[model samples]
Target: MPSVPPFPRASSRTHSSPVYRQRIRHTVPAAGCLAVLLFLIAFGSSTVSAQPADPAEHVSSTEPSTSSLSSPPQTIAFTGGAWYDGTGFVNDPLYIENGRFIAERPASIDTTIALDRHFVVPPFAEAHTHRIDQKGTLEGAVDAYLADGVFYVANLNNIPAFANPLRDTLDRENTVDVALAHGGFTSPGGHPQPLYERLVDRGIYSDWTKEQLAGQAFHAVTNSEELRTAYETIRADEPDLIKAYLMFAETKNASGLTPAVLAELVEMARTDGLRVSVHAQSANDMHIAAEAGAHQIAHMPPMPFQHDDGEKWYLIPDSTAQLLAEREVSVVTTTVLADGFDDGERKERVRSIQRENLSTLHDAGVHLLVGSDTWGTGQNEALYLHGLDVFDNQTLLRLWTDTGRSIFPDRAIGRLAPDHEASLLALTCNPLSDFTCVEKIDLRIKQGYVIELPPQTTSSP
Candidate 1:
């Protein structure tokens, strides 16, 4: 294996900085499988306790809570692991108090987990997905994400009626944190319209008709008047961010939102203190979205499957890449969706295009976020990116850790340091040596609370 990079030390007290060593003498245990030991350090002696209850029942908000008999320990220590500092790992003792990482120990220790010198990294995040918006399907997605160590998710498309009522079920310590872009702005006959229509045809939404799903599934607007009214309606619902659709906006007579309308929407979202994330299907769509000052491009342009066939419309030009970087816009790599191309030659061609586009965007200094547009978690997206050979193991790890910024910019997450969220994954091996080690998480922690799961039937990372 190649050598891991040196741990970059912090220059100041910022939470973004790497760990500054503070050695404390303690007896180190022999190497063994990770073990959970709860100790009430109020007095001199230690006491053992059973595993904590599900964190969902204890925490209602993002804030940490005091540990009760039903909740996990609030003041705890995770010792004997190589903690990832967003760049490299360092052997250290990580202390948590009140669901936040603290540099020093608290007055009283509530619990301790011995990692046995495993590799610890920040919890994973999914920057794009539409799976966690339904009432009946939310629990399954949450369980899958937690089992995969994906602590954060960004639901890029949803029906407010179906998704809004279920917001209270997530963003807690037990469940994965979520940000919803309810009912994206699209043309009358745009991308997601067809997708939802198909679902309705299949009986997934047995009650709703195609006419009723128009505004409920997506907001359709053509002129400035419709755009203004639609924006107001969505803003009243209070989405985490705004979602816009631009399908081949640069192409002549394209059936999507125009640049003027998208630009206006971006301005409105900014005025309301919300960011705009645009779903762009082609290179022209991406360019237009960036020019309109959209905060994020939901996907890297994929090869056209149904429309605009027989042309490399998805290939991003150098000038557009430069403009995207200049605009400070982030792009989510949903390149894994291209794997469904059944034709061997077409699949390889798409792969070549994907490799070139990823290289171009990375070279232009554009921020690339990891996201699986499928029902799966971000782990699959990271693995697919690895197959593209566009990024190495270290780069993939960093991108996965940094995904929280695109979903929740104000909160301190996607890093392991003082003042950051107390959430992480402890793997059995070094991911720097083998990227697949990320799937081998032995323990998962979120908000100073331990997340216990049933035995898995699948293979390890």
Candidate 2:
């Protein structure tokens, strides 16, 4: 069980919905990746079940025990290959059991299916998303990224009342595994003040009050006595992670937790076995949280993060950036927010800006994760949060799948390695090369069942 930041209390009016958000194979010296993928698809459809599904359903969690896999899913052999199975550069002779890899064959030649050929990167992960559940019922937004090879999502449960059940359902189904935060706690008038205030006014939430809207209630403990109590209180619930909103986003006088307070929170949380996700947008706040040893920074602000210089564009000072890199603190850029609008090309321009920044962060060796804080209305419909070229479905898929897996290493996401949970995607093409191929997602297999693809039928030999 992990404790996370609480979602901004919204009005009775619901905010965002999830329904948004690839592929391929190998060849002989000239057969091409597409050819190999087609062969594998035809072969796989022979023994496996590729059932039609909602674009957003979670995958199965069961890993075929070595016992069950004595005779595994039919293996496919492709050539001229490129793969990322934790081990780089695998040329053909790869085995795909169910959807997980089985073994590799050398110098391929046998069947129509190909494996070790085309680039086979791992599936993507969505570090910060509010996805729907398997039941089609809703506590929060649903995820529509299944067909695109996004194997897992780090859904933020800012609203436990709604999030807990959804998380439970995912676990029960062994569907898409979720690394979740219980809910973001906030001081009554904190960043979410407006959203929370609206909900109360609309009679949507009964526990509405200005005081409860602050940032402190959600994270900060005023004194040592409260500090100990806070740790125990959170400990009782047993959480996988803890998140803190250190800033006062909407206030006329925006503020953040004092350095001392933030330091205390980090220390206390670490002792209690909790990883921290700090919501710090500005460089000042980001550096502070970093110094305090926060594990991940929630979002990159509209501008580059910088020190006290106070430039118009948000920027991170060299020193702070270096420190963050050295500490290996991951920065999750939820570029979707800034790029959500289509205001006379304004959104597109913002998307461009984000691309440059994201690329820089990536080059800097900063573990950057793609997160579309697709909260609020119509957030997921922007075509691609961080997809193709700048924001296409392809880029989005890889970013979330392969890119996001590292965020939670212990979870073992992104690949179909031996003894790993069976999370895979069978798209129309190999997503590793042209992300655009994710648009070709013909099947999305979770544990073993095909999730969002058309049902597979036996094909004529």
Candidate 3:
């Protein structure tokens, strides 16, 4: 395979920069707003453990418990707003106690936030991103993601040595929540191996040898033994999910995992209680992944129809669509990157095929999730913006909210329900009316900690 372009890297000097600099843009209120203060009071008095809990039990505790008279859980009521609770919108008063929604309001409310003529929905998730690397660090990727109203992100392509430390640091610092696939399984000299090799040559990953980088950074398994070793190595990292690549053999020089191997990998992942997300770019590979029982397809496959030069084009076949739906495999629609393709007849043709592919998958009853697959930098903040061109407002919203919940089902995200996390985005304009309204976030509430954003400034004409 030809050497891919050198991946961006952060200078060693950049690593010494204060981490606080990354979060400087976010203005944390000194005493917080009424809602936030109430939340803190309730959270402090509640019995909810700080550690992770089962999703079904994420709601407020009902068991009576003695607390100091000076610090009782405060009841806060949010009235006069339309809430999108994942499935539909409802205009009602939502109550919160101990950082969780409650069905009934307390006899006496401590505070109330007037939300008249506003829309409240769960913060979004970027499901198929790859910005957890060093370069993204310098770019303030995590902070940018949070500022964009993304509460959670799945780093699909990860290098354990690099990703795990970064993830741990972020977790300890209470930054953003990230679901990681700590290095995916790929065939020998496969899709990402060539790219990773380039990064090493550029001195980005100079510390590790090529063999050490393989499998951990980009697995290049050629047989069962290699696959076994790679799987165990990745498993040691305790990944949230497992990822594998399945590209057509003829399309590129690098060899891809065969259907049999892919199936085995899926079985291994499931046996270990992990979900598998396969990277497949063509109908043939997609079919293999579906049949192998992969839980998610990282990208929407190219249309089944082929051009005269053998490039795949047009919409996917009905059979494939039905199989995908039956398997209940969600597709992460990462079509935003396609916009970077050089403008030409070929680009338009590919774009048309991709648009049709996503629409057909959606129509086929397959869950569509949003992902930018971009570096989540200032320049790439438009990840969620461009998708509006192809999908309707409601569909895109669901992709960003509901479908994303499927990735980390145990987390209290993607919904505004009793026990769900209090992370939410408040907008003056209803997104259902015009999705662009999402860009105008009036307030961002994450884990009940509110951060009021500064008003957007329009560029001078």
Candidate 4:
């Protein structure tokens, strides 16, 4: 088996519950078996099995059949299209088989797909988004993402109780892959607490009690001991990443984690073997998060200093940009969601600040990952439109493909290359020329499975 980092020793308090002990026993062995099976497959061994078998009786023969050893690989080829393989666009045919891209054509062809003048690019990644709904199925959200050629979605804010089951359902259905930051670390009455209260008051999750809501949505750490316990509790759910919220003190009616507490939380999460993603809206919060060793900035931070002449323009300081770049921390651009501001002037100012900050970060060599922070609906297209104001289509494509790959290095999702998953989007026109062409998605493929697009309705004349 491939070497893995040692699992952290859990405290007796962490495994105090019978249910927790049972989960550990079941999940650990299953995960270990999976790792061993994957290792065997990688090394070209046929000892693994789908079902339990007697190891001694199932030994492979030294002399294998010639036909079995020499059989040609199943091939599927796509002709007449330009492929954007993360770095550049190449006008050539691409081939795939067994859900992976092959360098050369196979001896025999199993299927051939004609692209005719379309642009084939890697499937998009929704790197930032919240829970689509607090109740019922996530089918609407999942379908919306898939329709927009987003095969992988990183749900930045999620309740473990809800996200875990939803992830399993989506995996079983083979619709979309979801990476969840199950809940987030925040102070009592912080950003999400107020938001969660509104959700409950609005009857969105009326069935949930206040205690349950707090348990699912907010970690609310006040001190070191609480911070440690929060880490253990959240880690027990096995989230893909950890999310920490850092709100400025100037924001009225909201409480937030102090810098010291935030730093401690980040350190504890890293020690537990999780990447820390922080939500920082203000410039100070952004600096604090970066200095605390966060792996990613979940949103573009607002500028700390504003012009006194009533101008909306704001610039990120060169020193802050350098710090982020030096740490190699990526920033997920959610500037598109600036439209949510109630004041028009405030909205414009925030947008201006985000654009300037994004430009600075990009110039400073910081990785910029594309994220919509909006629900997985028609908003996917809106994200592309909004991003055009700051980055060109080529850079935007890279944010979606190359930068996204860095977010999940173990998964083969965001690139068209050998040994990568056949997840891609076929656009009617080249997006590099006009980013708006993203809306004209001709087809979507996930893991070599073609997703049938919904038929368009014709209006009566």
Per lDDT, the best of the predicted structures is: 1
lDDT of 2 by residue, 136-225 (tens): 323222233433345456655344444454554454222345666654433334544465557557755345464553331243354556
**What are the Cα lDDT values of the candidates?**
0.76, 0.47, 0.61, 0.62
- TM-score per candidate: 0.86, 0.65, 0.77, 0.77
Give the backbone clash total of model 4: 0
Model 2 root mean square deviation, Cα atoms: 13.1
Model 2 spans > 4 angstroms off: 1-90, 96-100, 104-121, 132-143, 172-174, 185-188, 200-228, 248-252, 303-313, 342-356, 375-399, 416-419, 430-433, 452-461
Location of the lowest summed lDDT over 10 successive residues in candidate 3: 63-72
Tell me the TM-score of model 4.
Answer: 0.77
- For 185-251, candidate 4 gives per-residue lDDT tens digits of 8888777887777776786664766668665777888789888888788888888888888776334
Question: Model 1, stretches more than 4 Å misplaced?
Answer: 1-70, 303-311, 455-461
What's the CA RMSD of model 4 in angstroms? Answer: 15.4
Q: Write the per-residue lDDT of candidate 1 for residues 16-50, one digit (tens) a residue.
A: 22122111111122135444333333322232243
Compared with the true structure, model 1 gives a TM-score of 0.86
Tell me the deviation in Å of residue 442 in model 3.
1.7
